[model samples]
Target chain A: MTGQEPPKNPHGDDGPNPPDTGMGMTAVAYLLSGMLVWGGIGWLVDHWVGTRGIFAGLGAVLGMAGGVYLIVRRLGA
Target chain B: MAVQSMVLADVPFPPSVEDFYLPSILPWGEHDNYWFTKITALVWLSAALIIIFFLVAYRKPQLVPSKRQWLAESLYGFVRNNIAIEMIGPAGVRFAPYLTTLFTFILLNNFWGIVPLIQISPNSHIAFPAFLAVISYVMFIWVGIRHHGFVKYFKNSLIPPAPWFILPLLIPIEFFSNFLVRPFSLAVRLFANMFAGHMLLLVFTLGGFAMLNANAWFLPFSIVSWAMTIALTFLEFLVICLQAYVFTVLTASYVQGALADEH
Candidate 1:
């Protein structure tokens, strides 16, 4: 913690390296898991309530949005 | 055209998934025991090779390093300095041995795909990557729990620094992302890459042979296919190294994230 400075962008721009943030695959994973988990829950609720597939679709959209937001927050930090 | 069609019928051009499902060398029942496959053998071989390599390479220490010792040291240094240190800061030193082992183990197995006799990487099977991913996932969780108490780690991970009202929404998203997604993607990425690369090599090599037997007119095209196969072999060599490095770096980053006081 004391010895090394935080990583800087190799291009000399004020950005973190893609690998440093662990964005590339982890981001994709987050997005996918979000959709699957939330959407699955939604589907179960839909089945119970006998509503059409609407809630599942809504859940997927919400999940995607939440996933992206989470990625932004983590990477930006 | 008739001659071409006739010759083409004699040669199998495209290899299918069946081509990859090679028979086990031992007379073990194939479908009965999932572990009794050629891929399993390769996995054992890779593990043995890694153990033997380091043992032989570092048996003697000298003031001036020998070639074997130098190679071993450089590889260790690369992962220690570049990946673990860069990702985890000063605290990275303790994690270097684990990261180095992960890097070299993966690198050697992935490289076995291009080796003359061993044309298939064990990692082309999903099980190998999934196994590695599970180990990594467990390690990061253990590290996080050790650093901050188990309850605190879960609280920090799931409940992001957000409004109280948003906790319900954020908790599920964060939990799924951190726990479910991380290991799943790690396994899929490695498996998919190796699987596709091996399939592509199979196609080009087999296609060349098929084309050569198809017709005299197709002989030149066969040469082209073979040349492409050779070129892709070199590309796969680069990919093998890159994938190993990428896997090691990501694992280190996860460890770093776990150890961080602040998200």
Candidate 2:
């Protein structure tokens, strides 16, 4: 993924460039929010179910996955 | 003589975080309040300087720009062309004034850290950045709501076009990322940068002073400490300007996201 070439413009047309400078920061914001929101929910569920911290861990993993998905959908487009 | 007194002093020579906690200038009285603090005064001073600068620069319209007019125009042009237009497309023209004001205000206040007497950035206090972030937050939300009606905007924001079953999981993530994270990160970034930068300057400067009080054999090393202080000051100058630019650009990006048609 690190070495991948810039993808060719599928439209084969040169147009105004999309703003890419702030994309990395935006991606980070999305990732952090994802973890916090879902992880909080999971912690609450774990408390209710009388489990240890397992649900919070699971929520963080799922949140990260969701965050990546959102980043890909927004920036990849 | 001052160096001799400092050397003979029976206490620590270096400064501490308490040095940043300046006492309020005004004595407690009928008119005095917590709001009338040094940082508050500096904030007002920065605002006044920005207003006076442009007023003096553009008092006379010039077919061929004067030096002051050229400088003012260039600052405005940079924000308008590079940040506003680059981030939000043609529609960003309307936001040029606000972004330009924010950039200059932040840039001047950050630069205050290096000034001789006023040696701290107001933004080192989180309250300042938090206030600015809240303004940006309101602005983007207002823009989104205006562009898309109230119901449509929230619907588009929280409910990304995903399969129905997945939305239960996705909605929380989307809502958090959009509403909560945006402003929190914005405020923290500026506050942390300014706070760390000022603290670093304090460490080096105080270290140099402390070294000056060492024995005659060790006194020469103070030169090295002072040299490092000077070098760090130059680096801090770049950080001061760069942080201002970053804050403005991120703001424009958030505004762009809100105005975007897609989720």
Quality of model 1 by C-alpha lDDT: 0.80
Q: How well is each residue in B1-263 modelled by candidate 1, as lDDT tens digits?
A: 99866766766657887766777566765544454677878888989999998899889966678888888887877787788777777677789899999999999889888997788998998888999999999999999999989988888788777678766766798888888878887888888889899999989987987866766688889889989988999999998998898888889878877877655
Candidate 1 TM-score, true structure as reference = 0.87
Lowest summed-lDDT stretch of 10 residues in model 2 chain B?
Answer: B27-36
Docking quality category of candidate 2 according to DockQ thresholds: incorrect
Off by over 4 Å in 1: A1-19, B1-13, B28-37
Residue B43's lDDT in candidate 1: 82
**Predicted model with the maximum DockQ:** 1
- Candidate 2 residues A5-69, lDDT tens each? 22333111123326565888878877887788888889999999989989999999888888888
Query: Model 2's DockQ?
Result: 0.20
Output the TM-score of candidate 2. Answer: 0.89
